[model samples]
Target chain A: MLVLELMVVIFLASIVAGVIGSLVGLGGGVVVIPILTIGLGVDIHYAIGASIVSVIATSSGAAATYVKDKMTNLRVGMFLELATTTGAIIGALIAAYVSSIALELVFGVILLLSLIPLVRKIGEDIPVTPELVGLSKKLELTGSYVETDGSTVNYNATRPAQGLAGMLVAGLISGLLGIGSGTFKVLSMDLAMKLPMKVSTTTSNFMIGVTAAASAGIYFVRGDVDPIIVAPVALGILFGASLGAKALPRAKNPTVRKIFAIVLAIAGAEMVLRALGI
Target chain B: MSLGNPDSMNNVISKVLRYGVLLSAAVIVLGAALLAARDAFSPSASLLHYDPNQIPHGPFPVTFSSLTAGLATGSPDAIIELGVLLLLATPVSRVLFSVFLFAAEHNRAYVYITATVLTLLLFSMLVTPYIPVFGG
Candidate 1:
């Protein structure tokens, strides 16, 4: 009976997650985990496991559309995998054995820390000026995305010498915290690598699922993949993401924006508490 | 990056080549090590450090160093994790790149109003990683 009720809740939440995930470049998992853990009395570990899976599902679903439009740079995506996957697996293994407590604590800190930029509302958007060697050339990385006027904004990266270092940090953070480091990665690409904001965002979304999957694999083997725990949260996040995305263009006020920082704060606290076994 | 002419293109490509080589090497040698320094696999270190009798007065390991230890699984280099992140980088970068182009064309009203809001939305993440300064 409880399971039946939970299923309904999960379905509803999935819709919510879908909406929220789209609104925020970070996948629904990051949002869903906290709500499920703190608001609904679910376990943190289960929240992460489910969150990552949902990340993959949502990313792939959304990525298909972006890729068809030629927004994604496949070679660049493939190249960075060298660092992200390695970091993810290591991060996950650490989650399982090394002070599970610390994992929980860090998870919370990361979520809360995200608010710095969120609240600051970074307004810096520089043009793509060539600084370092252009990695785009070696990888044949170039694409033209549709601008607001429906005209195309065509650009390429200069080896974005700054991007790789940023990516490594992004990978470590994502693997360490189990939240998609999409926000961080995008910032790095834009500011450090001088890539266009759009490319940085799209590429980070493409990378999160795989990174999450790496840590998730370890959790699964260690018996942390609790479906009961996952079911409600996954469904909730998926739903949230769907809602968030749909609301992106239509929401008159972007209602989700103001509360976003608050949500992050709560999630952070939840992670710290869980890590401490509170 | 003079693309309208063939000779200029060649010159541009060579310059890019030289930069890419120097940059990649720097990243591999410095960035990889700086970030990966904390991302290594050291299981028992965190656990050993987690003496419940210590300061936080909790059963869990709540320190930043311990949390870092948690990220360090058995192996420092985990291929699967790195691959996933690399793959994710594509879509994320694309979106960020797209946003900038869109924002560039906006007026102050649009920039202050819509673009700012959008970027906030863009970087909004759900999970966190900080130690709670105080109990609720």
Candidate 2:
């Protein structure tokens, strides 16, 4: 393909990936990586580089809206960031030692594992009552946000130590795989920390960019980030994520989630197969 | 809104993030335009060609000095790299801003927390590259 044609194709594909990613609550990296590597035959390292950059774009873009809505617990997000950033650095260091095939295999497994929470709908909708809140108070991991119905909801996070541990793993996966690892983050905030679902999701969104950025610098230094590849991917994902955010309120369909899940599963399996030389 | 309200802090941070993303996107689009124009003039250039072991045609600027040097030469890739760097820095800036926000609120605990997070981010992004094992 001509250079322009190739860039246009990658750009268009990234837009679709961004839309699906935001709609399904998966960040752009998971979808973008598969398209770049498995679909376009780009080298995994470059694909990862592009994917991680786009991850920052989409996350920051979406986070702006979420933060404005006051759903994101800024305190919790920043505090947990302490763990995620450290984990991201470690993960990036480890990425340097791992082979492309190994990276692909791990990416495939993480992709599949990420779906489990969405499949089971593990995030709870019930408002947390701020019980068992000693750690949250001590650490100030509590906040209030206005609900859609013009009511205020107050909540406190429980299990900070465990939450930080989960965030570390989330950051590790994000750095190594060049994805946001939002599922793990939501799990940590929702299941481990007992934060409300809205807080968990938005806070997870808030933190994703920082976690990805922590490792993106390393990728850039390693020369994995090609300007030509990342420019289109970043712009495409940013555009698509904005569209997805606007569409989300009206298009919260279970069927859409199911279809996206199946597509991601096939993509993940293909990645695993490719890594295994199948 | 009062400074005590959590919403006030979010309002400032959110604006910063939104503008940061927009600025980076605009910069990237400008870079892409330059690249397309260059390719249009020289039809034989395969800018999209990828090789894992080698950079495509020109030097891919990864360091700040190289980025500046490339920009001085009007290199489109350097502009794009600058955009990417700006995007990566957006979240880091947010964390940094949070330190100030917490300090303004007289929230000593969170001030310390945000500062620690910022230090970790800088350490990973800036300091780690100097370490032999982590850099490569």
Using all chains and alpha carbons, the TM-scores for the candidates as numbered come to 0.55, 0.87
Docking class of 2: medium
Q: List the residue pairs that clash in candidate 2.
A: none
Model 1 CA deviation exceeding 4 Å by range: A93-121, A124-128, A131-134, A158-161, A229-278, B1-136
Q: Look at candidate 2 and tell me the lDDT of residue A163.
A: 95
Model 2: residue B111 alpha-carbon error in angstroms = 0.8
Please give, for residues B93-116, the per-residue lDDT of candidate 1 as tens digits.
433433343344432332233233
What interface RMSD does every candidate have?
A: 17.2, 2.4
In candidate 2, chain A reaches a TM of 0.82
TM-score of chain A of each: 0.75, 0.82
lDDT of 2 by residue, B1-136 (tens): 6666656898989988999999999999999999888877884544554443354435789888999999999899999999998898899889988898888888998998899989989888887766788745
DockQ of each: 0.02, 0.65
Q: Give Cα-based local distance difference scores for all models.
A: 0.47, 0.77
